[model samples]
Target: MLSETNKKILSLAVPAAFSNLFDMIQVIVDMIMLGRVSPVAIAAAGISMQFLGLLYAFMASFSVGNSAVVSRFVGAKELDEASKTTFTSSVIAFLISIPFTIFGVFFSKYVFIFMGSSEEVVKAGETYLSIISLTFPVIFIEFALYSSLNASGDTKTPLKIVVVANVINTVLAYTLIFGKFGFPALGIKGAAIATAISYYISFVLYLYVFLTKKSIVSFYPLFVKDYAKRVLGIGIPAGVERVITYFSFLLFVKMIAEYGTYTLAGYQVGLRIEGLAFMPGFGFTIAAMTLVGQSIGAKNYEEAQKLGWQTAKIASVFMGFMGVLMFLFPQYFAMIFTNDEKVIQEAILYLKVVGLTQVPLAIGFVLSGALRGAGSTKLTLLINTASLWFFRIIPAYVLSKMFGNVLYIYYAMFVETFLKAGILYYMFKKGYWKRQVKWKT
Candidate 1:
């Protein structure tokens, strides 16, 4: 009864969804352990993670570009070219990560201070940030490899790697955070070490897969300037999009920080819980990106368009169901992370408010991914940048100043999601991507 396209989408999406689910579970476990330590601990770790997101923002450049380009190559049956692009992209990503590592090691404390964190939080976050920063190159290289693998429809490999990595991270985090198994209790620092170790191990596993030729894209280690240009051409806009978006997110977090430690902790808990709902959407987004790229590569633009809409429709259903749960019983979710009454109340407000936006968020995720797959990164960049700033951040800023209520700020976010989804749907329907993409290589 299932169409071949539908089955292909699920084959990619189902594995990816489980991968994201495990990833979220790992983060939730970390936050749960940190919460047991104190609300300040949760705030410290949460802020540190946001600051670290800058590294991922930078990684987005090559990772996304690699996906857009390499997926097409795979679709066209050009395995050698895909391998070269993957290798070139990986090298560039590693080089880019070095400076970030140095900066994070030396200047992490300054980031906390700049974010207006309290002394306790600043002290707690400093070591964690520094330790996590050390893994930047590992993170960058592995993400590049993983993106290539997924583009080639090998999501299952990454899922396996993540499952093992999460197990290692969770066990190490629990042991080191609590001084179990004769390990000294390092608290936040322990969490950082666990994360760094898992990243390094995962990178090694990914590299092994490529070197052994177990993956669709092998580890060729060749640098092709033309290929690099092709990749970066598509990636730069995506990278800029991520950089600006994350910077805005940090600014958004800074605004939330003004509400005090308890509120920030609550927000962090709610974010982790909300991330659970994002798993299905994230999986389908990857599906759209890969399938669309492949379809476009085969010069089947109609199939590409159809695939995008199908993926978005499926993602909306899953995310909308999750929205219902969050809207109805946020406190049940909040309790899994922490027991503090004030924190629970703040988290409850956040979950309930954000619950309304899940379907729209799902729409935006998959369609933008589809656009990126069609080599329309610039279009996505424009849509995301304009929407984030004009609809979300600026409005949230004014509302926060006027009412001084985080609820109004959240409502601004809720409104922006719908607007962004509408714009993305319009662009996807307009079929601009069919005209925009002209394949080279």
Candidate 2:
């Protein structure tokens, strides 16, 4: 019933979706374990995760650029070029992550205090953030390899590795946090240690895959300046976009924090739960990126456009269904992460409010990936930065000040998603990306 093109999309998308889901599970597990500790624990860990997220956002440039370049090479049947790009990208990723890792380890306490947390939250977050920071280089290296494999049309290997790593994280967190099986109870420190261990293991597994020649790309370390330049040239805009976007998001988080500790914790819980909807959207986005990049490399421009739209159509269906479930069962989902009645109530409101935005969010996700895959990262950078500040952040800030209720802030988020989705659809249809990129490879 499905064409080969459609089947190819699913082949890449399904495994990638599961991988993203498992990745989110790692964070959700942290929240769940910490939630049992205290509401303050939840708030503290949440802030630490957000800071880590900022670092990931910056690293996204290398991943996105690497995917675009490497996918094009694979499509063109240039395996040697693809392998060189991967090694250079990985090296760049490791180098850039070092500074952030050092900053996070040394200045984590100051970061929490600047986040306007209570004294208990600041102390707890300091411990968690400092421990987690040790894994920044490991995470970047793992992600570089992960993205390379996906671009080369091998998503299943990464998926398998992530599932096993997630299991390890869960079991370790349970034993360490509760002092089971000869482990001493270390509270937040224990959770952070579990997280760091799992990341290192995942990196090692990825390395093994490359070294064994099981992967499409090999693990030989190379520093190709031309390749690195090309990758960064394509990625810098996306990276800059991420820096601005995350900064804006942190401001949004600060606004939510103004309400109180319980509200911040509830917001974090809702975000972790809503991450369920994001996994499929992200997966399909990868599918679009890979398919479109390959199609363009073969110079089949129409097929590239068709694949992009097809990916968006499928992603919207899954995301829309998730929205319905979130709208109907917000309370049940909220309860999984926290027992505090106040936190539960706030999370319920957030889920109910955000549930309606899923479909548009899906379109935004897949289309942007398509554009970036075609080396239109600059376009995405402009659109995302402008829409975030104009439609989301500024309005949310004004609403937070004008009304005592947080409901207006949630409404602003919905409006931004709707507008951004529409703009992305228009850009994709106009075929600007095809004209904008002149492939250097």
lDDT top scorer: 1
Clashing pairs in 2: none
TM-scores for all predictions:
0.92, 0.91
Candidate 1 to truth, TM: 0.92
Cα shift from native, residue 415, model 2 (Å): 2.3
**Candidate 1 C-alpha lDDT tens digits along 228-341:** 988899998999999999889878887898989988989988998899888888899999999999888778899899999999998999999999999999999999888999
- Poorest stretch of ten by lDDT in candidate 1: 47-56
Question: Candidate 2 — number of clashing residue pairs?
Answer: 0
Clashes of each: 0, 0
* C-alpha lDDT values of all predictions: 0.91, 0.89
lDDT of 1: 0.91
Model 2 residue runs over 4 Å out of place are 36-43, 117-124, 257-269, 328-332, 335-349, 399-405
- Span of 10 residues, lowest total lDDT, candidate 2: 215-224
